[model samples]
Target: MEQNRCEKSTLLLSVVIGVALHGSYSTLFNPLTGPWSIFPLISLVLAVYCLYQRYLNQPMTDGMPKLIFSFFLLGLFGYNAYLKTSNPEMGSNFFSSVCIVIIAYGFIVKLNSVNVYVNRKKTLRKHRKQSNINCYQLLVVNTARF
Candidate 1:
């Protein structure tokens, strides 16, 4: 069914986001220490939760998970930009972080759009079913009058 396909696509998107988060963490924060280490861990946990939700056929309609990841990536991009400004040697990191941020933003937009589509489809189906039931009831009433 279309719903199943939507669920699968959402799951795939979540997996991609997870992989991207891991890549960003590895590339940008290798040997990360202090309180900064928690950011990636938080992202990882959110990704896992999102995946689990999708697996359960309860994909979040609010797009909160992707939004959170996008915000995290934006913060990372800002930090990298600041570091690059202070030390030109960090240019590569800054560039990579920028790329990651852009990619994450794109994915987030896509994921949210997909979620909206699924939701609309679900609502349409519900309305169709309701209308069918109403039609059936009307038919039954007319038949009874005979």
Candidate 2:
């Protein structure tokens, strides 16, 4: 259960970070106007929440947060890429963003795998200890019967 929570948190954090970066990039390069400008604010809020989660060492267990943010980032990236398709200069920026997101995602996956392996080792050690205790108790009970 803890592992599941950790995994969820890691995924959420990654997505939030990605969105924040993308938002900042958009704000700097494209500068959304009027009501649409609220996007950067929303991204700021998410970035703060991400920091708070990290500080508290607690992550949201629900999958909704990550899913929603992931979709938002995907849409934003797609729209931006589509808009810049005709511009040759923006191609490098788009490529770099894609590479960064991929690297971050890969890192998180590797971290989660390591976390799972460590948790499994701990569980196995606990089981071994319990088995030893049971064996010792049985030995003592048999000796007492004699």
RMSD of each: 8.9, 7.0
Worst 10-residue stretch by lDDT in candidate 1? 30-39
Residue 9, model 2: lDDT of 61
Local accuracy of candidate 2 as per-residue lDDT tens digits, 1-146:
77767665655565566566656666566633112355766776876686566647754444545554554565456545544564545554566469548755855886698789989999999999999999999999999999
Off by over 4 Å in 2: 1-14, 31-36, 53-89, 92-123, 126-134, 137-146
Candidate 1 runs further than 4 Å off: 1-92
Taking the tens digit of each residue's C-alpha lDDT, what string does model 1 give over 1-146?
77656655565555455554654565466443223445555666776676666658755546556554555555456555544565565445757566677867787788798889989999999999999999999999999999
* Candidates' C-alpha lDDT: 0.63, 0.63
Model 1 misses residue 96 by how many Å? 1.8
